[model samples]
Target chain A: MSLLQTIFEETFKISYEEANQDLAMQDVANWDSLTHMDLISAIEDKLAIRLSSDEIADMTSFDAIKRIVNEHQ
Target chain B: MHNIIVFGTGKISESCSYYLTKKYNIFAYVCDNDFVTDEPFLGKPVIAIDSVAKSYPPNEYAAFVAVGYQELNTLRESKVEQLTTLGYQLVSYYPQHTPINGPIGHNSMIMDDAVIQPCVTVGNNVLVWGGAMVGHHSVLQDHCWISGGCAIGGGATIGERTFVGINATLGNAITVGRDAIIGSGAICNKCIAEGSVLITAETPTYRLNSHQFIRFSSEFNSRN
Candidate 1:
């Protein structure tokens, strides 16, 4: 899956179209701490890769997340 | 009456002993894995845990796992399964002092001294530690642990596998997502999304009459 699509699906638990740069971190209703960990766990499980604590902490925006995921790829 | 034996000597186990012994004629009170208590608990003989099988057949007794929350809920889950596979019926204990409004599903170990207010929904295999209070209309999903002295407010929904730390307080109308850990003594006034970790800043204390030229304790107390 594309990184953008993954982020959108992860943040919103919705389809790819819902994922956009305009998506605010706090706007999503389900974007609680438990779901945040679920998103990270899902991404790692899907791509078979682990994200560093620094990378995880720094990930707050779609653009920054794209960069981190692309580097992992 | 059915033969119900409570394992472990923890506070929960003791409460179970006190309650169940009054209701049923329990065969023996299982103490430590090795030594049995000389006196009976509430008039039932107290024996060691390991001697459970030796004294009676596995089918002869129903066992309740009264141990507290282990590392990551591992200890309770493992012991529940172990007792079941041994052909012993798994018993659940819920205190009547807890005012549960909605249906509490199977195998819940609710300790004494906890106050579950009205309109609270608790799922199966859950543990409500002693002195915890579930406020009215709060929905707690399955496998959640509400530690001792924790207070969940009304109109809150705690998702599955979540751990509410000791004395953590959630304000009314807040929603905590699945698998979230509310740190000890945390006071949440807003919705915590799934998997979030929250901590509250701790206040320092000092002796009231240390000649420190100030007194803050009485002032803080009166304000609240």
Candidate 2:
């Protein structure tokens, strides 16, 4: 499973198949502000990295977040 | 009376000036050199922050930072640190109606109609806006901003530099971490991690017209 898929599953309680790059905060049913924060937290924990406020705000899609995580790592 | 200097000339600074005038002697309003205007604020001179220490020695005149939440409260936090480093004693403002049962940190502001229940710990540079409620035993860390009508439940812990929007609520024993932002009308029952931003779901709008229903009701009333 991909890192984004794991984050979506753990933070939003969604299936791995549903956690695709196309899935975004606006498109996903469960990706409200609360879940968005949870996802950020989960990503930070799994990756062992902290994200700035601007970075958190820019994470609108799974693809964008994955790229950011890759860059940080 | 103790001589005090108010930093900033914004709305929060104006409110702080109004509150501080009753107890202390407000010497002047201090801000950046670019923000300095010719006109006086509340009949006191608005001077540059860099020049304030030279005129009014830090030992003689204390300072109060009246800036509101900007940059998710990081700005206010930085201002507090800067003023402290300049050797100025930071002053706190609490309205007469607000009841603080426990010790609150310096440079904090508790506006009118806000209630701080027993055993609550409020840290430095915190801002509790009007009509907010801090439940018993709750801990609000340094540089946090609790907006109007927020209800923080008992024993809840709000981490440093967090921003709680107006009318937001937190369940008892919940913990919100540093740099968090809880949007207006949001209700949180679980613990929130650091740098989290939580907001309520938008309300769905209906397509039905209310004017048609009103017309039908009037016709039925006339027939009866």
Candidate 3:
């Protein structure tokens, strides 16, 4: 499994199958603002990449997060 | 004295260790393998969390997640949950200089000079910083951050992961919702809803009673 997928599964308590590109914050039960920040921090730490406030705010979906990760890469 | 392993190498961990050393002997500072450093913390060796269970063992020592109230205390809560999952008994720190006539839940921290009045229920992973005063019969929910010098009135219910900023006054019998951020110097008497960002230039006094606070507190209790 991809690192991002694993992080999503752990953070949202979702299955690996559910942590796809179509996944959105509204679909997750535990996707509150605090948990969202946790997800961002986890991503930054695991990927060794920093995300700006705007990118963090816009990363409401898995697709958006992937786009930001691509930009950092 | 029992040996306690503190998680983190930052200032909060240093402060926690200073108090923890008074009651228990600090074993080592625990951090993730990714962030492990060569230098010691507060004169003790730093151990990786993954290897701590093998070296120290959970049955022999206790753990204190001394992480600060970052991400609205969720980070501390996560560390507490991690330690619990590893079968480590979590310990709460009740600072000296006040007799807390209340029950403080596991992993909660009462910093120096923080007063907890009678019948207060401090939930798990709550962080009450120095000089904070929680009045009688208040309910501080899990993962809440009561900043330094904040005065919480009696019978008030602080919501989960909510941050009552420095010197913020939560009037008597008020209820603040989960994830709400009350800025510094705000004296709030209103029922703050979940995810609210309340910023005040001056203390705004408004009385909200008759079941609103009760409702929010009940939801908070039922969740935990």
The TM-score measured for candidate 2 stands at 0.69
Put down candidate 2 lDDT per residue, B49-168, tens digits, no spaces. 788889888999998898989898787778778888989999887876454556679999887668888778889889998889999989999999999999999999999999999999
TM-score of chain A for candidate 2?
Answer: 0.87
How many clashing residue pairs are found in candidate 3? 0
Off by over 4 Å in 3: A1-73, B96-102, B201-224
For residues B79-130, what per-residue lDDT tens digits would candidate 3 score against the true structure?
8998888889888878654445456788888876787787788888888888
Task: State the TM-score for model 3.
Answer: 0.65
TM-score of each: 0.56, 0.69, 0.65
Root-mean-square deviation of candidate 3 = 21.8
Model 1 lDDT tens row, A1-73: 5755675676567756667544444545565444555666677777778887656655554566678888998
Worst 10 residues of 1 chain A by lDDT: A20-29
**lDDT at position B91, candidate 2:** 85
Score residue B7 of candidate 2 by CA lDDT.
Answer: 88
lDDT of 3 at B19: 75
DockQ of 2: 0.01
Residue pairs in candidate 3 whose N, alpha carbon or C atoms collide under 3 angstroms: none
The residue ranges of model 1 lying beyond 4 angstroms of the native Cα positions read A1-73, B20-26, B29-54, B97-103, B193-195, B207-224
